[model samples]
Structure formats: C-alpha cells, structure tokens
Target: MQWITIFKKEILEDWRNYKWIWVPLVFIVICIMDPISTYYLPQILESVGGMPEGTVLEPPEVVPSQAIMMSLTELSMLGVLVIVAISMSVIAGERKSGVAELILVKPVSYFTYISAKWAEKLLLVFTSYLIGMLASWYYVDLLFGQITAGQFFSLFFFYLIWLIFVISLTIFYNTIVKVPGLVLTLTVVTIMAMSAINQIFSYRMPWFPNSISGHITKMLMENSVPNALWGAVSITIILSVGLLIASNFILKTKEMAD
Candidate 1:
C-alpha cells in the first residue's frame, strides 16, 4: 500500500512534468529512425553530396538483427544521456523543493520513498524501451529481412536487464548528490567509465551490465549467448539491490534540504 501510494505520486509528478510523454517519444524516434534512415542512406548520401561519376552506389547489406542492434546502440549512447538528463531531478529536484523533507516528516520509510522512485523510473525506462524496440523490430523486418522470433526476443530480453541497471544506478546517484548537473555528470561518468574498464578486461568480466550492450550485439551476429552473460545478469541483479540499499541509507542520513 505504501509503495503503491508513492508510486502513484511519482507517476502523477512525471505526468505533470510531461516526462511520461516526451521520454517515450524520444525513444520511439531513436528506434524508428535507425531502420528508416538506414533504408534510405544511399539516397541521403547522394542528395547531400553527389557521388563521383562512375562510382557504384552499392550500400552494404543491412541485416535485420544488426539494424535493431544499431537502434539499441543509439539508445545506449544518446538515449541514456537523454533519459538520465530528464530523470536526474527525481530525487534532487524533490530535495531542492523541500518535498523530500515534507514527505519524510510523515510515517514514510526511506526504503519506501526510495524504492518508489526506483520502481517508477524503472517502469518508465523499460516501458519506453520495449515500445521503441518492438517498433524497431517491425520496421527492420520490413526494410531489411526477418530475424527469427527466438533471436530477436533473446537480444531484447537480455538488453532490457542491463537497462534496468542503468536506471537504477542513476536513481542511486541522485540520492547521493543534490546538484542535478553534478549528479548527471557523475552518473554518466561512472557508468561510462565502468563500461570502458569492462571493455579492457572483457574476458574476465563479461557479465558486467555495460557489457550487455556488446553481448546483445554479439547475440544478434551470432545465434548463441556467451556463457559469461548469465554472470553479468547475476551481477547486475546483485548490484541493483546493493544500490537500493545504499540509496536508502543516504536518503535517511544525508538527504536533507539545503
């Protein structure tokens, strides 16, 4: 009941702020743009700058899986930045407005307050992703070729798990930092830095959430998931729980308004 109450409040706030609408629209554009643009890339290149005479305008073949994967990569780089930028103020904004203090004065636990943020944002992230991805999948089939349902869903399912880690980590960072700009920078830097580190030692830490993007690409190109991928899922789950606890602790001790 407590979580439901907080979840409703979070949703209403997002609605009022237009996050519920614009965030999904951003993802949909990113997803659909990939296939549509790739399908017309040759035309686009030709129109922008004329190709040399006698040059064969043969574009490389676009595979359905690869097209979808590219759409997700857009999500990873630009999409993560957009989503984090929009949701960066979840905790930080509340604290600045003194809403956090007002809520804490009542019979609310920090765990519930924090979990509500985590859950609502997670829902926002995943729901937008799924819709965008499904649209991408359809257009990929239309523009390129069809991938087996098994292959497409496998790629999507695993990628979604990693996205959960992204949203959760951002929420966790927001709890610790009060400045939205600093929070945004730190969250992006930390996650991107971790991804870069994992890339350096990929063989040893294939299960890292950052690695999931590459793994999904791998799955698209190859039919099988690498054995180490499950480890990444397990690690992400454990890390998500740890982040929730850390955020809860911070909200209780240091989440005061300035």
Candidate 2:
C-alpha cells in the first residue's frame, strides 16, 4: 500500500514536471528524424549544392532493416543520454531537497521507497523507448520497405534490456551520490568504461553486460541471436538486480547511520 502511495506520488511529480509528455516526445522525435533523414539524405545533399563542380551525387540504397537499425543506433546514443539526464536526480534530488528524509521518517521502508522509484523510472523509459522505436519502424517501413515483425521485435527486446540495465545503474549511483552532477558523471564514466572494456576484450568477455549491444547488432544484421546472447542477457539481468539490491543496501546503511 505504501509502495503504491509512493508510486502514485512519483507519477504526479513526473506529470507536474512534464516528463511524461516531453520525454516520450523527445524520443519519438529523435527516432522519427533518423528514418526521414536517411530517406531524404541524397536529395537534401544535392539541393544544398555543396559538392565540387564535377561531383556526381548518387542516391544510397538503404534497406528497411538497415534504416531501422540506424535509427536504433542513434537511439542508443542520444536516447541513452536523455534517459540518464532525466533519471539522474531520481534519488539524489529527493535527498538534496530533504524530501527523502521526510518520507523515510514516516511509515515506509527504504526498500519500498527505492522499489517504487525504480519501478516508475523503468516504466517510463520502457514506454518511451517502445513508442519511439515503433514510430521509427513505421517510417522506415513507409520509406524503404517492410521490416518483418520478427526483426523489429528482436531489436526491441534486446535494446530494451540494455536500457533497463542503464536505468538500474543510474538509480544505484543516485542513491550513493547526493550531487546529481557527480552522479551523472559517475554513471556515464562507468558505462563508457564498460563499453571500452567490452570492445577491447569481446571474445573473452562475451558475457559482459555491455556485450548485449554487440549481440543486438549481430542479431539485426544476421537475423539470428548470437551464441553469447543468452550469456550477455543473463549477466546483464544479474548485474541490474545486483545494482538495485546494492542501492537498497546503501540506503539502508545511510538510514542506520542517521
């Protein structure tokens, strides 16, 4: 009951902040632009007339699947930044403003508090991403060709896992770091480090969380899941759960100290 109460409160807070509207709009706009831009790139480039006098501009032959994948590539970069920026303050902001302390003084457990916030954020990110991807799929289909349901859903599934993993990491940092800027820095740096490590040692570390992105790409291009897909997914889910548990543990410890 208290978790529901907290959940409803978070929903109201997000609504008041216009996050519910603008976050999805930002995602949809970013995704839709990818397909449209790709489709019209040749025409747009020629119209600008910036090429040398003898340069012949040829239109690119982009398939629907490639177009959709390109949209997701942009989504993974820009969309992940949007996700991190929006969720950077989930717990840190509350702690900074003293709202977290006030809430904990009431009849609520820290686990309940953290779980509610985590659930709200996960839902928001997932929904925003799904809508954005679907919109991109539609445009890619209209412009290039039809992308099969299997291809679209496969991309959505793994990418969704990657997004959830990032959300968990952000919330974990939010709990320990009271400064949102530092929290953002730490989360971004950790993600970049993981990606770099995965890139450097992909063969040895196929099970790493960051490897999920590689598997997603492999699945899209080859139309099949990599042998490491399950391993990467399993590790990512475990790490995400571990981060949330650690977040709850850190919050509990902080509460004990106070």
Give candidate 1's error at residue 99 in angstroms.
1.4
Question: What does the lDDT come to for candidate 1?
Answer: 0.83
- The local distance difference test score of each candidate is 0.83, 0.85
Backbone clashes, candidate 1:
1
lDDT at position 84, candidate 1: 82
Q: Estimate each model's TM-score.
A: 0.94, 0.94
Q: Where does the lowest 10-residue lDDT sum fall in candidate 1? A: 249-258
> C-alpha displacement of 95 in model 2, angstroms?
0.7
TM-score: model 2 vs. ground truth: 0.94
User: RMSD per prediction, one decimal?
Assistant: 1.5, 1.7
Error of 2 at 53 (Å): 4.1
Q: Write the residue-wise lDDT of candidate 1 on 125-221 in tens digits.
A: 8888888888888888888889788987888788778777777788888888877887889889988899789889988877777888787777777
For model 2, name the residue pairs that clash: none
Report, for all candidates in order, the number of backbone clashes: 1, 0
